[model samples]
Target: MNNKPYQRSELIYKDKIKKIKDSNIIIFGLGGVGSVAAESISRNFIKNLTIVDYDIYEVSNLNRQLYSNYDNIGKKKVDVLKENIKKHCKDTNIVARGEKVTDSNIEGFFNINYDYVIDAVDDVKAKLAIIKYCRDNNIPVVSCMGTGNRINPQMLTIDDIFKTFNCPLAKKMRKELKRLGILSLDTVFSKEKPVETVDKKLGSTSFVPGSAGLLLASYVINKIAFEE
Candidate 1:
């Protein structure tokens, strides 16, 4: 009778549980991808987590977003996520920041000094700001790219941003990062050619986005928990 909340993770990871629990990670964006990543991280007994998002849940989000539901509609993502994680994962210290990360306020936004940063944002400028800030500070970070419009979860791969294919978002980020002389980025990207949408709005799937989110969390956790 394993009575511990995170006994499963503690069991498999063995002596690495404390390192996993001590990881101070911050994730930006709480849509389908980031929300799922937070859940995975929290379940792994990550004790310190910070989730940032300025958006509220909308009716449209229920289709793919992990945290979106009728009860949470119109509620801020960070607040909902914070409430949920704290209630279920009592050992975690969750910080919910309802501010949009932008170029102007980025310095203040990153005041907490996370050991690992996850970029799950959709905005180009916001993503750029986050990567650059982390790069400058020498903090390890991973960015999620183009999970939208992708259907095949198996096609998703984690690699350097420079090598990612079939992801328009990765292509755009490549050009911008090059201009900034940022040579490399740890990225989670889909190799699936996106199914074009007639309305031009990014289409999403519940599985792939959440899968990518798990990949992001796994990458971060592996570094923190398994590294020598």
Candidate 2:
């Protein structure tokens, strides 16, 4: 059967396979956008990854979180993400932490060294901490803003954090970061008002956090893979 060393050819091109080999990436959240972002990056075959989150999968997370599933309920998002990535890309290195990122643990969390830092956390304080740390270290970073509402994924755009407007989260972040003298940073936010309903919930079922996470992932991949 066609055994002319054909299978060996597949191995030869292995080295030529363009991947994020040897690059270090840290994602600081494992929720809706963060979980999906982590999964998307892992699929790119990044060499090293560090995911930090203290939350666990819950039924509510199934709505937008990438790693949410009935069987994974109560399991830490970092652990679940790690398992899923290993199943897909065994060659990639991963480090998962079941702890929140804060001022006290920020240094320890990022002390491992990294090429890029992705801020996916929902908490304003934590987001600020990560951004400050990344800026101080001169590491490339991309943050995500309100993805809770908005049905049109096309509305999501990446821009300097200070340039973002309309979105509530971005407005708050801009004010806080500006007060701290952090003028500009990359972020994914919508220019339109996020879709809110009469119920006043953060978002509706159709327009939710997934798109925001995907946008964040796209920015990160572009920055890391293409070095843009």
In the range 1-228, model 1's lDDT, one tens digit per residue, is 878887878878888988888778999998999999998888876768989999999998998887789999999999988888877889778888999998888888666667799999999999999999899999889999989888899998999999999888899999999999998999999989999998888888889999999999999988998777
lDDT of each: 0.89, 0.79
Clashing residue pairs in candidate 1 (N, C-alpha, C atoms within 3 angstroms): none
Q: Tell me how candidate 1 scores on lDDT.
A: 0.89
The sequence of per-residue lDDT tens digits that candidate 2 reaches over residues 46-103 is 6788999999888888777886889999888888889888997787789998987787
Top TM-score prediction, candidate number: 1
Q: Can you give the TM-score per candidate against the true fold?
A: 0.96, 0.87
The predictions' CA RMSDs to the true structure, in order, are 1.2, 4.3
Stretches off by above 4 angstroms in model 1 are none
Q: Evaluate candidate 2 by giving its C-alpha RMSD to the native, one decimal.
A: 4.3
